[model samples]
Target: MSTIAPARVVLEAAGIRKQFPGVVALDDVSLRLRSGEIQALVGENGAGKSTLIKILTGVYQPDAGSVTIDGAPVRFGSARDALKAGISVVHQEHNLIPQFTVAENILLERIPTRLPQLVDYAAIYREARPWMKTVGLDMPATRSVSALSAAQMQLVEIAKALSLQARILLLDEPTAAITPHETGYLFRVLRELRAQGVAVVFVSHKLEEVFELADRVTVLRDGRNTALDHEIKGLTQDQMVTYMIGRSDVLAQLPARPARGEPVLEVRDLATEAGARGITFSLHRGEILGLYGLVGAGRTELAKAIIGELKVTGGDVLVRGRSARIRDLRDALARHRIGYVSENRKEEGLILLHSVLTNMSITIWRRLRLFGQWIRRSSETAAVMPLVKQLDVRAHSLAQQVGTLSGGNQQKVSLGKWLAADVEILIIDEPTIGIDIKTKNALHELIWNLAANGKAIMVISSDMPEIVRLADRILIMRNHRLVGDISNSHDYEEVSAAIMSRLS
Candidate 1:
């Protein structure tokens, strides 16, 4: 008699289907993750990747279908319940409390206490040391989370997950905020975890990293599995790209940078109270100037100071060769014709529950008011539609909630608002973040088109290839100071080497 082999799958979602009023978020989607393997979950925004992950991690209950662990069906009523089932997640967003110590945050549920119910501070630190060491995260357990950088906070999240003694791990955009050096260390940790037979589900928009780390891949599109559990060997990135986007015609080539015109904006001795110091750069019309740096290098702080989000301790921001005093964001946008798209798009960029029409038109509302204190909805719709269409935002209608759209589409919506305002100088921070290859190409084309039209554009990105691909000139920032500048000739290798040299 022949015996059947037992299933090695550690975590799986079988035939998942989810619905939210008008949207079918997931339709018969299936994913299987085995022990000792890293399975990549990839798709365009709104392709149902997040929804499926939430189901596996117990954040959302699937309308239909079941989740299984080790061939045993399980129902998770809460995130805590999933944790108890040996599944843990490291979210893209930091979930730790700012006021709490790293150890307290990591061991919140299982803190050791004395007879008087007083927290055992010494034990708390010791409990977290092993997990932290596993990931090469060096930090005092007593340090406040607010004191840590974005990359350090991410490492804490990973350590916290490991503290749960999880066999199945889900990491969402884990490297989104980390530096390349830190990412290399993180990859080593993950490889070690895999060798120890831990199953991992990795989700990210950075295709290069996915290709480098994933042993197998799964592609989702429109809530269904288009490419389920595909092995990495013999599969080209081009083939995988086609699977997620569902078309080969999507533009991949970025246009050449337009000829540099006279300076549209100049920052002289720019210093912000938040730590950006002595930043000096002149952005010319028809030029896409990129700012590249590691996380917490004062890049975002510099942008904030220029746009008046952060109080400028000292500096002269000149517009068209003339000093323009930006009192606030409104002054920057309305008076100086400058606009900024923040890095934290979900929180600072859009009011998620609002409609797409509202999100795109919000910035231009001062102009949208027909009569005193009266705004015409039709006029608002008409004003933003052309730009929305230009960005190719996929939505059910103009009235559809912005939060319900895919990541790529939502980013377009965020960009659309600035376009609607018709700003002279636009600063976009990590525009293609969480965006697929096709959508990224479309965004690149739109960016170049704007610069080519004589609108000065400044792109701030942590991505080397992205900056190298798009920038005519790249500026490097380190420790709140301008360190180096390199003109791009589209030679990614040489440009990246030059960047690392300065950073090192």
Candidate 2:
């Protein structure tokens, strides 16, 4: 562990209170961040963690409160103003323009110039190289931003913030999509930044990383401060979860059971145009069959191909022992009672600019027709609202845009959409990615309940614990082929070792 000494407060939010249409996002909350410290903010979905970050980063103005830096109160009208005040945020979504070069994106605001305000390309690259080196981003400055990987884009975001001379940095779910190897590199950079007296405010759902990297933690629950500011020393993950969810009891766990009856779905010799080759699997009714693999191991591609998103070159999909040919996503959903939930929810799984009700009712409109042609709004709401409530989605109303909701809540909506459509065979990929522990448990329970009600669930995930806890049977894929298949007896180490052996 790195040695550190307590320092003065660099930032503070006092008596914060923010209210939305029908919810109190923050209620008299307070938080303090010290210089040269990593302050982790943790909470369940819709606990007002995002609201607080928005208020601090100038995305939204607080209804009541004061934000101070170095004992001086300041008001920022916009994100640019906040950046000028030495506050910069690295959001989950990349903010850089994809068409721009790495150097151009890093120094976008203050590009170098020669006589007559001419854009100096050489000077821009030279200025961007130092910040990139400082953040340990080892990519060519002339490369396009779109060509970089997720981890590379994250590092570029940090470089851009450093180029702005940011004293206080705010990061939201920085490791959600990246691999563990990339996460190690990110932590190494954070440690170097911490030693340089920078104040980092990290907001993430991963509690293990929070405990490992943060010096102090602030826990929020139901729009109020449970632990406003507490040191991480002597704190356990279980204790932290208790503060966030107001419960110390163990989460409800499902017992293993054998799935009976005929298989709901059977894929034989599946071949997808998206690099999947010779994939074969069978999912029985009321079974939670899990596909476990590393990232880019053809798990998602196989799911998409089965759902008709990608073209299938050679394979057969049998639904309830009958061969089925799908035309597209709509045909797959309507003709066959098959639904697919994407792992990348923001881009593929959701329409972020629309209302939550609208996104959920996307597939329901065709189902709730008055004369088999027209959709009745009343009937649609009556059918979807129950599933929303059953899923425990925290929102002011159905009219709220899903983009404003937390990541976990948005995931709930994505799952609920399929449930609303009454799909018997459901395929959910990465259901608990970037979700808090409490929410993760709730989702697992929901999945278990769905399966108990006779819905065949096929889960594709890279999370080993999720697979071990939720699946009855596990299949491992390595280099686009099924390498191993085994029963999960609630033993994590055994399944993990078996999967690794197959991969090796």
Candidate 3:
């Protein structure tokens, strides 16, 4: 009987080491990607997954290592050089220009031109059609990318990569924002790419996706390789967790608590300008109320409406049984002692250009003021330092820019600012999105503890496992309205089924 031949290695990195100031990002890490295969690169945030990707994509040069493509040694001085070498990346953040058409974004690198350096619109659309079809993107080439959904935008990124004739494609946290149906579509596309002899590197915090998609896995821990290209068929999820965190238990079980005191915040028939209609909910003291939904299901909109970010056209908001009129986010925090930790930390949650001290203390700057106007630096430092230490923020110093920290640390800073504000009610949106498993567990524990200490927290998340684990009760929303409210028993299968049923 004849057997199929093993796939050949298309790309290899050996003895890769990278270091940043005050931290060794990677130490002697290596990865190999075979043609017609999907290789999963996973690790805790700050464990050097991003660093290695940057090295391979020529965004950052490795301190000591060698990269070879098809048995030929190569050094890329820039991202353009890597692209020329048939390597392309679709980052977690969408890289498409908002105002540009699909055709323009897909063929941006080498747009066809007419005389006098004019863009050839007809040629651009014609050239982009095949790549768009390859990725199952059926949108018109003339459509502006800003109008597309998150899933659609991702397909455009993939189409753009294909337009470059990339032999190897790297996707970073590709499904962190999409729904289950959308994720299945993405997996289908990746499988098709693998069949076409393309090498793919998939990076994600979600292990289930890694198991479902990747053929082999390379696990990283503490900036080093724990498992290098192990076949996925032979490994269990527990084993993968062990490889990642040196422990079998990925997340510690939070203790169940009896329902506490009367409602701390009550929303009655809340109608928002952002499409949330007739939303009514009561969050009691020390309760972790989960708001679960698919993308654009108004979970975030509900939170924004509650925090006064969205205009409440018709609603009665009661805080501690008293009617409250919160004018804006400042009013929500100062007058009502309610704080919001936004999911888009890079944009709304944090001032990335500023120091950690500045971002952490910004929420309480008014409270820290003395003499009716002047703020004391000593008082601010004293107040913010405890939160910094409590959150275990991994920064060299308070002066370090928030932009320089890892995804996990930046999130901690985002949460820390609210803790500094000493808010009684907190709305946390997508608390663990784009973070690693270990950091995710840490954040989950922190939220649980806050609720245990009599703080009302409304968590908005698309991750079912997270909502099930951390929430005492879940409120399901669909099509800008609440569909079901269920108490949690903490059984994944049971809770997930009920959650999905609500969506259906």
Best by lDDT: 3
Instruction: Please give me the total number of clashing residue pairs in predicted model 3.
Output: 0
Q: Candidate 3 on 338-377: residue-level lDDT in tens?
A: 9999989999999999999999999988878898898898
lDDT tens digits, residues 205-321, model 2? 888789889988999998899997798988887789899998864454476555545798999998878777777889998899999988878888888889888899998999989
Q: TM-scores for all candidates?
A: 0.87, 0.90, 0.95
lDDT of 3 at 345: 92
Ranking by TM-score: 3, 2, 1
Question: How many angstroms is residue 81 displaced in model 3 relative to the true structure, after the best TM-score fit?
Answer: 2.8
Query: Each prediction's Cα RMSD?
Result: 4.2, 2.8, 2.3
Q: Which should have the higher lDDT, number 1 or number 3?
A: 3
In order, what lDDT does every prediction score? 0.87, 0.88, 0.91
- Give me candidate 3's TM-score against the actual structure: 0.95
lDDT of 1 by residue, 1-504 (tens): 001123278887889999999999999999988888888999887789888888887899999998988889999998999999999888888889999998888887788897578889899999988887887778788899999877788778878888889889899988877778778888888888887778889998888888899888999988999898888778887888889887765645475655789999999988889887788889999999999998779888889889888888888889998998788788898888899998888999999999999999998888889776878998998998898778898998999999998778989998899989889899999888767777888888888999999999999999888898889999999999999978987877899999999999
